[model samples]
Target chain A: MAHIHLGEGSFPLWALVLWTLLGVGLISAVVYRVRKGGIKTHQIALAGIAAAASFAIFQLNIPVWGGIHMNLTGLVGILAGPLLGALIALVVNIFSAALGHGAVGLLGANTLVNASEAIVAYYAFKTLIGMDWDVFPASASAATLGLSAGAFLMGAIIVVSGVNGSALPRGDLTIAVAGLVGLNLFAAFLAAGYWGFTVTGGAMPWAKRSAKALQRGVQEGGGALVELGRGIVVAGPIRKGGLMVEFGALVLVLGVLGIGLYVYVDRYGGFEDGERPAR
Target chain B: MTVTTLSNHVPDPRLVTAFAEQRDGPLHRVNPWTKIGIVGALVLAVTVFDRLALLAGLYGAVLVVYGLAGLPYRRLAGWYTLPLLFIVSVAGPLTFLEPGTPIGGTLPTPLGELSVTWAGIVLFAELSCRSLTVVTFALTASMTTKYTDVAYMLGRLLPRPIDQIALLTYRFTFVMLETLEDLVKAALSRGANFSEFWSNKRLYARILGMTMLSAIEQSERLVKSMEARGYNGDITLYGDVSRPPIHELFVVIGSYVAVVGYAAVAVYGVRQ
Candidate 1:
């Protein structure tokens, strides 16, 4: 039972240190690339803003699939690219650690896991963006595959840490390995699905288009506010009423679904051990 | 539960005093690598052994070393209690030793028939002590050694190529942090207020895109400065100062004695 339960509980300090060095090196090299790109100062300023906002995005821990929730640091990596994005994620995770989300010791492994996802997402998007395939299919497929890559790497790190010739039994090590695979992959898939749906807004070229349209709608709404401030005769109350009506309907639908979920979970699936009730 | 001295706004005076005393302390006179080597051996001795009483003895020996090093008990206790409460509340509940499925006590149902036998309590206590022992020693090392010294030691132990990268990463960490702070302040001043940015997706996108561009640009500038100064994939660092022979010998001999003492206590306790 201890073999299954504890399953290779020790970590090699040297291995952890070495991995941290490698992870930090990868981030530093990325920083070097960003410096060499010779972008305009304002653009550089913009990038900093983007990175900080992305850091906030990583902290926004929304519930997703599979009964597991984690910060979307990996997605930020994809959007920011390997170098700058990874650096930001490293900073964010460090702050998160100080808040007790995870240990300072696991920083290297966590950074690598999230950074790989980001790198993979960037390349995947670039590869499939203008390809002659259906945009949704390509985006969804890329996202799904990228998520699996993150999960596999996280699992592999755990397995590697458990290896100690002659000291730990093979069976015990395997149990630990399996446990990591189950936990990480389960969380990864749910996160990938949520990101693909809400953030991507339907996937591929279409996802990009939807996001752009939403952005335009928001821009138009801002323009309306400005127009009202100028006291000029603009789009009448009817158009404003119509927009509000549409928004109200959408909110109403989501509110109903959320309440439904609350009721269902309350009736069945008694909250798991160690889980705090929704406040 | 509130024992977080390291991050506390009002730092402990004893910690400050102990740290100040360490400026002219014995450990400072010892070679960094020697301290590291002894730390490594002690880490292995603690981790590879799972015996509870053994871990407690290890903890005892560590307390004595800290006492000798002039580390205040209040400071140590402050740092140690949080992880201790965490282990008891979480790991303790999970470590239910199945001693013949001991009679289900009259504990409430939501607590889930917690059939904790004597063995379970003992195991949890041991594991918690073991973790605290290693953690305290780590804190001691961190409290004493400067980060640069650790990086320098790594530079000595590792090949020149690998060590160079380590040095660069360590040096630039603070610089990047400052850049991040400045960027965040700039954003707040430039109308990307938190509530508006979050509620409006377009504003959020603009904010995100802008931040990314700036971070990339900042990174590029940093790299260029490094390159201009003849930084070509390798980092060069300064030399290490000589340590007194007596201090080095104490670290070496004291570490051995501590490990042996821990083992003896463990063996005796287990036999009983």
Candidate 2:
């Protein structure tokens, strides 16, 4: 979901080298750990299958956000251990790059983005499970958190590497990336929130009741904002609705923040006509 | 879109493998290592050269080589869609953002005045060339090189379990893809509609979850079968890639030297 789709030469040579070296370092450590620990055969099989599934699903576009594919790196991390999950990330990226889905030059950067997702998701899922959380909530939350981490990491990578030939200053680029990452996080949260709401069977009833109350309040000359605030604070019969409300507020905030950053970059990002930054 | 339709748009591993195995062109006979080395050189060259003419020339040369290799030009053009989309998305904003002599008069936008500059157009073209050059060559290499050679190369290049996993994954991706296709078909036949994401989020999640569960079970069965065959953990590929010939080696070296020399001159202003 957070894959960097930039083609070759999008990053400068130094940034490319830096990311490639970091990527190599990561894979080297993973390899060393696997060699020292000696993986079980069953785990190897699982990793192999997980990689296949992840790669296949990476291309499978679901009807979301006008056709987007899910990474499933989170699920890969949970199913295959982190060590193997990280390896799977490398494998998937290699295959994808080979097939021209991603740039061969950005393999290192892309690998880092994806491997982090799997690693974070694995640990997050484990931690949540350890905390006695239900499987659905724990997995969903962990996946969302993991994907969010990937999105932020991707943003950082683009900001640090800096797009070649882009006229935007580092500051403006950071703002643009922040906006993009914010939007990505918003989508992740919205999907996770909706998934949670539907699975828990608490959102529909509460949402319907809230809608009626909101309409009544508006008809009675009360503002929709007042009704929304009331709905948030009321804490109705469905306790899970609180989680949805929290998710709703978060999604709204992220959406606003993302759009605001885009607007900010558009208006004041130093792209004024006929004015070039002093190189 | 349904999985079946969407699958058509994606680069099919099967088609890639078919091209690699069936094509008996000059490139097909070349050593995988040589092709891989050339790919590396191309990457370096594209990374170093920023001039629009040089980039376009490089892209033109790559396309000629691709054509010479007996690869399908039509399919190659088709495959350009993703890279093109990526280039536009990243560089699209730059066209308006880069300051230069505006090609068209600035238009009033909600955020500010917007105009495409000559410099911005040049930037976009350069980026597009850089992206497509690598993408085209990468596809050329993959299509020309057989999957067994690829698996063998991975086995030699990567470490123990990583190599093993990659090899297995490459083979099983087809199986999993088939399974996924079947699942999608079954869902569609059972009146499952995936046209809307928000409304069908549950169905999407369920289909994905089912695929995961099936993969887990498939892996369990695979483990038992492999264990029965005395497989301990190592997966060995019998196929091997021959070392690059001396001339090919020189060509590869010459390409690298050319890139290094170009970079020194282009970037550092080093005199020949």
Kindly give the number of clashing pairs for every candidate: 24, 0
The sequence of per-residue lDDT tens digits that candidate 2 reaches over residues A1-279 is 577757898887767776786787667656654654456677788788878888777667776645666657876766665667678889898888888888888998999898888767766766776678755576678778878888899988898777876667777677666767887788777765447445533243233332232122123210111123336421112233434454455446544654565455446644364443222
The parts of candidate 2 lying over 4 Å away from their true place are A196-279, B1-6, B109-111
Q: Residue B48 in model 2: shift from native, Å?
A: 0.7
* Alpha-carbon RMSD, each predicted model: 17.9, 12.6
Query: Cα miss at A279, model 1 (Å)?
Result: 41
- Tell me the docking grade of candidate 1: incorrect
DockQ of candidate 2?
Answer: 0.37
Q: Write the residue-wise lDDT of candidate 2 on B106-157 in tens digits.
A: 9998988889988778888988999989888998899999888999998898
Give candidate 1's root-mean-square deviation (CA, Å).
17.9
Cα lDDT tens digits, model 1, B1-272, are 12212133222322442473445555454565565556555555654455666667877987787676655677566555445543543334334422323445735577355466554555456556655665565555545665557556656754333344334434443344344345445665886554432244333333333333444445457566656777554456666634536867686778777666654464223233
Q: Best-fitting candidate, measured by DockQ? A: 2
